[model samples]
Target: MNATVLKFGGSSFRHTEDYHRVAGHIADRLATGEGKIVAVVSAMSGITDNLKEVMLNVNKKASPSNVDAALATGEMISACCLEAAISRLRIPVMSLNGYSLGIRTNSDFGRASIESVDPKQIMAALLEHDVIVAAGAQAIDQSGRLTFLGRNSSDLTAIVIASMLGEHACEIYSDVPGVYTADPYLVPGAQLIPELAYQTILQMSLHGAKVLHHRGVHYAEKHRVSIICKSLTSDGAITGTIVSGHGNARSVTVARDSPVFSCASLEECDSLCALLARHDINVLRLEDSHGVRVCIVSDIDFAQRLVSLADIGPVFIGLSNVVTELDSSGLLVHLVGDYDGAISLVRQIHEQMYPAVVSVPFGASV
Candidate 1:
């Protein structure tokens, strides 16, 4: 009835050998008497996109249900790989996919919202195994069809597991150890935020920070589950930031690759926005002399599906990047037409808010 919940993102599995490495880490944790653990896993890097490309190439008009079935396989394969690695380490381990995860959602396919979670199966399995690897970002619908929660949503899966099992905290491992004032890779001056409030992090995610999924943050906040952001390294696990009820920081978020569409009329844009919101998609509306432009920063494919479903004749205006700065005053959004400009603006804003640390050694002064 008691277990620790952890999640490993795609970046953790860049190569096949990384699976064994993660399994070794899990074994090491067990050696430290961490007790039974539930490790949620995402698809190997680029595999989901590859799968989607192959599926779409074969059938451009495939139903969303079928697409979900195809995309869900990536996580299932990862679960199997990690399970095998753990078993090779002479550990009692099992893996579960959407079919048996006991988490149910509506038939929303690409961005399904979790409706109910029955932890009996997971608990029963834990009684027989020390580790249970649950495929993340996937659940089943009422009709028992596979459903993908959303892109980069494995975080939600991990948090949901922790909440259902009555755990107060969960660990999420990614390429970056924790959240930063700006993307560390792009902005050399970016500083790692040691702690952040639930709402603060949630806004960052909503603006396309990529550190965590917004839905997952919302769920964690609602369930009062603290999120421990960490990264596994050669030395060991490094805890970067903890997200709970308190803490605040000024940060800049840049969503470099977002799709934008031009609606013929304001009414059409409004209708499309409402439709997308119902499916839990975040949209930014911009009005100009030409028409209404709607930008979708996350779940682009699902947003396209919704647009198609609505039969709105919105012209594709191509991708527009978003750079946002959040501080004590408020959030300021900047829409850039090019990636270079977005990156430049991010550095400029990051430098202004985190000025004193810009000259210090990267990743050291913070």
Candidate 2:
């Protein structure tokens, strides 16, 4: 049997009108014989943020368990709303919470991993129902404790479900039309890439691209699942980025001429690592020559957190001068297609920027 999993982001479920739009989209797809379109939905926009605020107010040092409990409510509410929307259409649907099903996970709380998912009941229900609205980002532990997947957890939910069902495709519906060379809002004249190899998307996601979550992309790559990212506003017709298993072997070349800030002290290193880990920041490299130099590509919030941690006297010292060189405008150029083309591009960049190549860490080759 053919199946495609559909996942909608928080922004797509912001209001009742948005729910109607989702229902309409599903109905249209159902009419076209789109077999077993499992729907994975995120919380309404800003609900998770509000929940975090409440958690912070209750306890300044909220543990991961407390945070998971607070955040899981967002997805619960979203699932309920979506169930109602689907029901209004007289469609047979099953709204499931992670607890209701035997989706066991570890006790990591905020970043829990799924230990096992008993899909027998879910599969049976899907066969009889028109839609299955599963709460995204949440799972129950073996001890019956609620756990949450980290940020953008909805994408991970869709991927896991698709993998379990052996679905051919997983469609991620979001506000953006598709994956682009750079964030269109930040970079003018950025072009949307029609097709991307799985490794290319993985690299882009790892390097701060917000179109797809890293865990979700990794899962899809592992399972050889095709992923299509499209805008919810586009009626699902305007094709977005198609990520598949096979593509021409390619290499990406990136060059930057920015001053590298060096940090010293074991305490500083530990503190930075902890802060970045908490924020799910990805660090590319950390080298120690005369001093400690760490390179990372992440969101602005992560950078701010690092700066804040550095301000304290315990972990870091004598590194204030290096902080002034921080630039948010660092350009990242990625070339993904043919391997020969990638090599040519890297050669061209190396020639243009004749600085000693200090570090070159190989990323996904697609």
Candidate 3:
């Protein structure tokens, strides 16, 4: 039989009614003999927040050890609840925790890296059971310390499990129907993009798109796992974003000598670097200028980070034109390339508007 891994977000299994719905969904899928199914679950809605509140109340500055211990309750509660619900269907279900299954990770308390998963035990449990409910977002480190896999870590857990199982696909059920060109709530006209390259999804997530966590996508891409982002509550057709590996698309390289914007404080610079790294943005060159750091983006998108850096500190003080007010936020207008036509258009604009002579910068093509 084929294998499939399904991850349910906290919002989907928030209450008893939601649990019943999830159970029914699973039952229906099982009845069809679709495949061997593994269900990964996050804590019910608001449970993590409540747990964090308790931690803060006891100690405003809780140590990493205390925080992981406290934060783990959420996923534990979720796993137990899911197991109980699945039991009602009389399906041989097993609930596995990170510690019991020997899914080891790094020492990071809140955001641990999964070191390895003992597939033998996990596969044995799956072969003997109808459904296996595993706690999401929590993993045991090499030192046996409990670790929480940061926010949206459940997605990572599902992808990892699917990769280990050699499953054909990983289905991530969430509140949204699918991925949209823009946040549908913010931009009502945002259209749903049925298919997108993994790189595009990475770029979208980096640029304020909150559909899927970046780490989850990275794991899926690396493991060659096909992902489907669909709704948990609806039997509605598979209506969500599908993330796949990079494909053959025309490659266009634009070089530019524009003034690069950068942050000053080392702490702020590091934070920016982390943020860019999380988004998989590649920095071509980084240099220090009079104590300020300048990062050039040869590849990957850094336009959004540039604007954010500008807002925090480090205004553009380089030779490039101060077109900061351009509507092209989170977008790079390549300024280097053979573009006589672009220069002609700039001259036309300059003729229209006096004083603000549009400078084409020789080979500029923004």
Against the true structure, whose lDDT is highest?
A: 1
Query: Sorted by lDDT, highest first, which candidate order results?
Result: 1, 2, 3
Q: List model 1 lDDT by residue over 1-366, tens digit each.
A: 679999999999999999999999999999999889999999999999999999999999898999999999999999999999999999999999998888999998888999999998998999999999999999999999999998889999999999999999999999989998888888887788999999999989989799898999999999999999999988899999999999889999988778888988889888888888887677899998766899997678778887877767888878889899898787899899889988988888988887787354554534
lDDT digits (tens) for residues 1-366 of candidate 2: 355788999979778788878988988899988777788899999998899899899897777777888899898888888888888999888888777645678886666777787777678778899798988988888888888877677888888888888786788888776776544543333446787877777766665567788778877888888889888764354567888875321222232221233456666666666666765665433444546544444433234435554653332222111011101234344423343454454454443343443333222122
In candidate 3, what are the lDDT values of residues 1-366, reduced to their tens digit? 356789988878767778778877888888988566788988888888789889989997778767887888788888888888889989788888777655788775666677787777778887888888888888888778788877667888888889888885889888776676444543333445676677766655533356676677778888899889888645443666778974322111222233455666777666666665664454422453456554444222224434444436655544221111111133433232234543433333333433343333321334
Q: Which structure is stronger by TM-score: 1 or 2?
A: 1
lDDT of 1: 0.91
TM-score of each model, in listed order: 0.97, 0.74, 0.70
lDDT of each: 0.91, 0.68, 0.65
True-structure lDDT of candidate 2 = 0.68
- RMSD of candidates 1 onward, in order: 1.6, 9.4, 11.4
lDDT of 3 at 97: 77
Model 1 bad stretches (over 4 Å) = 359-366
Q: Tell me the deviation in Å of residue 290 in model 2.
A: 10
Higher-TM-score candidate of 1 and 3: 1
lDDT of 2 at 142: 81
